[model samples]
Target chain A: MKKRAQEVERALDVLLPLPEGPEKRLIEAMRYAVLGGGKRLRGFLVMEVASLFSVAPACAARVAASVEMLHAYSLVHDDLPAMDDDDLRRGQPSCHKAFDEATAILAGDALLTRAFEVLVDVDTHSDSQARCELVAALGAASGARGMVGGQMIDMLSEGQDLSGAEVTRLQALKTGRLIQYSAEAGAILGRAPSHQRHLIAAFGRDLGAAFQIADDILDTEGTAEEIGKTAGKDEAAGKATMVSIMGLEQARAHASMLAEQAANYLSSFGEKAANLVALTDFVVSRRS
Target chain B: MKKRAQEVERALDVLLPLPEGPEKRLIEAMRYAVLGGGKRLRGFLVMEVASLFSVAPACAARVAASVEMLHAYSLVHDDLPAMDDDDLRRGQPSCHKAFDEATAILAGDALLTRAFEVLVDVDTHSDSQARCELVAALGAASGARGMVGGQMIDMLSEGQDLSGAEVTRLQALKTGRLIQYSAEAGAILGRAPSHQRHLIAAFGRDLGAAFQIADDILDTEGTAEEIGKTAGKDEAAGKATMVSIMGLEQARAHASMLAEQAANYLSSFGEKAANLVALTDFVVSRRS
Candidate 1:
């Protein structure tokens, strides 16, 4: 997983070189927001899933980098004063804090646009069909009905009582879709069979649920240094989460169950998906 | 032109119907920001250029609507308090004014994502290559080195002295690239020959230059009622513009010259490009 993260970090550097223009600051902000940060869990998922199909590492790295770019854009925008207003991310100042709010916003916008641009490039996939599918799938995962829509629900549900089902649906849309897309991307690139793709997608969905619940737990228990950002922010903001609705112990139990279920979906792949299975365990039990 | 605008409006409505969910408000903000507004110059450019190659109207309309969606997204984000801070757009309250800042930002992000989504759909083009080309071109035009880059420069250059050349480069990145893409989109959709595509791109480039100068002139001369938004906000914000630097008369003369030059680039198409040539004149002369 660390190796895959390093490869994705290098890929991101190549994809987002600083240009010689007035917009260099924007590019710099984008690089700062994305490069050398995060657990790269999504990147690792893309590479691992692609490896199951024996896909080219370079191609997988490109997709992984694109996902990271999209994720970074989301984080940059989410930290804006109008949104979560986070001042720190990954142990450093957030994009809006590092740069001015306007630059941060433009950086996020440009990063999102660049993510699509990278996916559609010929280098990402020789086949135009695969490239188009990547663009379409990413759009579907990140657009109104997916990540962005999930964010909308998150913002609206703040300080409001939400049932467990409502919270699950919200988390599924907000973050699960992108994580699901990260896993399904390998299937699309490798032209995996429909049934196999469905299995991988299900694996991603369950894994994402487990990941979010674990995140909620971390927010509840981890420190600022351990988590790399503000801890207990969800509780402070009155944001609805599984931990908020079900108590810490119940949430942790549910996350563990979901993680195990996520790993079981890869049973058909046998030893080929061992690392992915291990990842499921890591997501639920990791300290950070 | 009005007919094409209406067609594009209908296409947008079809592409972005509100869903029954918590995110419905986000979609509503997106719809409100895009529908029944603007001169639809970019949409008309796509249709007219597509008509020159006898492309299907349905296909052309889809591309037109996508361009408008992208344009609308830029407008929504640009109007945010952190950016341009305008409360009015197209004679109505802007997205942030009507809804909220967070919703407006998400709506802009979703609109941009949806624009690419629509482009990649099979309904937009039967050939995946064409859809990929559209995606790549739009991404190139709107990404960091394109419209978003231009916005970054615009923000950084506010209240700063800039040379005429610097200002031209800024505007070219900010607005010209997207306008160029809109005209070139028809060629991409129609699968025009490379030479023909280049010609259309050149025409669009010059036309966009003319259109921006005219807009600067409008900001200098017209009222909010005439222009459908705050007219003199540019000068008020101390924003760098051609009219601010070159003065009204020289700017008008330059715009007219560019319009003529833009029309001449479409000379190879002869009468088939009459409407496009007429558009160059209309853009420079229109009050709004």
Candidate 2:
């Protein structure tokens, strides 16, 4: 996972080389948001899944970078005062704090736009059909019915008591869509059969749910230094989360069950799915 | 132009069909922002140039709508409190004012994402290569090197004196890139030769500059009622504009020269370029 994250970091540098000019600040902000930190879990997922299909590392690298860029944009926006309002991210000042709000917003916008550009480039995929499919799929994952929609639901549901199912649906929309896309990108790139793709997608969905539950658990139990962000924000904000709805113990059990179910979907890949299965365990068991 | 605008409007509706459930608010905000008002000059440029290539209206319409959505997203973000901070847009409350800040942000994000999706959809183009080209061009026009960069320059340069050359470069980045892409979309769709695409791009460049100059002029001369947006905002904000850099008469002359130069580039198409020629004149002459 660390090796894949490093590969993605290098690919991102090559893809977004610094330019000389006044507009260079925009690129700087973009680089800061993307290159600074994070587990690069989404990028890792893209590479791991692509490895299953024996896709070239170069091809998978760009796809992974694209997902990382998209994830970075979401975090930048989510950290804005209008959204989650976090001042710290990955133990550093968030994008809005490092720069001004306007610059941060434009940086996020550029990153998102650049992600699609990266996916559609000839270096990413030789076939136009594959490129278009990737673009369309990423759009569905990031747009109204995906990440943004989930964000809207999350903000709206704040302060209002939400049932366990409602919280699950909220998390599904907010984070699940992009997580699923990250895992499914490999199959799209590899031209996997429908059944195999379905299995991979299901693995992603279960893994994503487990991942969010684990995150909620961390919010309640971890320290700010360990989490690299303010701890207990969800509870302080009275935001609906799996832990809040299911209770901490139940949420942990549910997450473990989901991790197992996520691994079960990978049985088709047999022993080759070891990395993904390990990833599922890592997601649920991470301390931060 | 009015006829083309209406066609673009209908295409937007078709491209972004209404959805039921929680995400409907997002769709509504998108529709309200895109459908409520605008001259649809970008869409008109797309269809008019595509007409020269004999590309089907159906194909051209989707491209036009995509540009419109992109433009609408810029407007929505530009109007946010942290940016331009305008409450009014096209005689209506801006998205944030109408739908709240979080929803407005999501709607803008969705619109931007949807633009790429619209371009790549099979219905937009039977040729995957054409769709890929369209996606790439739009991405280039909208990303850090283009519109967003221009916006960043605009904000940073606020209240600071700038030379005419600096202002031109700023506007070119802020708005010229997408305007250029709108014209280039036709050539990509029609599979025009390289030199022809360059000609169309140059025409878009000149026309976009002239259109911006005319807009600046209207900002000085027109009322809010006439313009459908706040009048005199440029002066009030103390922002540098074409009028601010060049004296008013010189600015007008520059715009007129650009309009003529823009028309000259379309001469390769002769009579087929008639609408484009007329558009250059309209761009400089329109009150709104």
Candidate 3:
């Protein structure tokens, strides 16, 4: 919707078709899955962080591309019949709905595998160690203890009462981990020290928590038309969402608190963190 | 299994569990998918190549473990009902049959993502440039243009007439790419030069093709009991295979010929390649 968002969108348009051959059709399907409009929040975070340090525009674009692929993968599987079972994503038929279920499965697999391919073969990033760190961060966040684990917990807790802390832990793993990696991955490539890494990761954690809480609030407070996909699906599934456990008012306040915490982390970076600052606000108040 | 195979197997034995925790179940499932029995060819390739250049044992084995994880993910997805529809794999019910379809899908996803994590986290390898090369090779082989593209072609070509060249191209991408990767990946980690790298890859190409030809022969010639899975399901599915395109006798001759080509590549390495030599013969003759 915004200019930077437009830039990320255009960048993806060109990068997604880089591979050729029998992969041509499948890669087309995968690129469509990614370019199928979203907030592009994760890609924004990567580009914003890179812009802060004046890192080369081209290298930053590569990181933005990598994170988007990871995000696309999460969405595809999350909407699968066995997982969240939604029929729509980003205002159109979901991947599994648009494509066959098996194709959707393979599409997600292809995207996830291809993300690392972008990093390893990156002609622009000559620093292999930095590239390796980015790969590790991305992998850890998406692996067993990250998004997939969070999904499993989400599934298991559907009919059970989970404690507030349990819900946060699960949400952090499922949503926060990748968000954390988004920022950390950018910083790793930029050669941030240990403390700077922690600082950025802290920002991602708070931003992700606020993002999820805002989602919970929107699920209860927003209309289905406004949200694009199914709203209140969490309640229908008996999910232990913030809105369900703590009520709408508390969830809204909690998310606001997390948003402010996210902004606080960027204070160390000064005016250069303008995009990051706007991002925290976007995380808290966006409808979709 | 021999001693080193047992060593890698033992690491896998302990690596598969996560105890009782938020991420435990998903992690356990991923471990179970890999820990199941199969020929240790991929792992052996990593270790043997690492051994050739005297890389540390853990460095070599870590890459081996990641290769096994990727290999296992392929097996899991290939056995799904929409794919090959095979009921058994490696003498056990397929992951989908043993676990639910959803778990099998996620297990494959987790394993694929975790392979890159293992690559980055392990500290035994010394060459930053070479490590990146290793990562590139693995990603190329595992992603759409290599394994997944080949898989898509494999799926699309079902019930179609195929020529010998088409079958070779399919098999080269689907099977040979990763096997070629297994050898080159290890040699890269050991800091082998471009020429040396080319040699190992050449060896892998010949050996992997030989192995696949033997597999075609097995489909026509071996019993299910000996192969540990369904035999000749390819022809029943009306998918053109090497044995179908060329007669079984010709297929057997092709396999033996490929094995000789594989052996020829290894003569450059002198006697240090004994295990690789033995492995070539082993691959051609393997019943299971």
Which candidate comes out best when scored by lDDT?
1
lDDT per residue for candidate 1 within B221-262, as digits (tens), equals: 999999989989888989889998999999999999999999
**CAPRI class of candidate 1:** high
* Per-residue accuracy of model 1 over A93-211 as CA lDDT, tens digit each: 99989988998888999989988988888364458888899899999999999999999999999999999999999999999999999999988888889999999999999999999
Report the C-alpha lDDT of model 2 over B1-288, residue by residue, as the tens digit: 899999999999988888886778888999999999798999999998888888999889999999999999999999999999999899999999999877787788899999999999936445888899899999999999999999998988889999899999998888888999999998888899999999999999999999889999999989998988889999999899999888789999999999999999988799888889999999988988
- Which 10 successive residues of model 3 chain A have the least lDDT summed? A15-24
Better model by DockQ: candidate 1 vs candidate 2:
1
DockQ of each: 0.92, 0.86, 0.71
C-alpha lDDT of all candidate models, in order? 0.92, 0.91, 0.82
Candidate 3 residue-wise lDDT, A1-288, digit = tens: 266667777777776665655556677678768988888788878877766666776777777888888899988988888778899787788887887676777778888988887877655457787887788788888888788888888887887999899999999988999888878777876777788778898999999999999988888877777887888888899889888888888898999999999999989899889879988888887877
Please give, as one word, the docking class of candidate 3: medium
TM-score of each: 0.98, 0.98, 0.96
Chain B TM-score of every predicted model: 0.98, 0.98, 0.95
lDDT of 3 by residue, B1-288 (tens): 376676667666655557587567677667767887778888898888878888887777878888889998988888887678888887778888887777777888889988877777666544566666667788888887888888888887888888899899999989999999888877877788788888899999999899888887887788888887898788788878788988888887888888888888888889998998889888888877
TM-score of chain A of each: 0.98, 0.98, 0.95
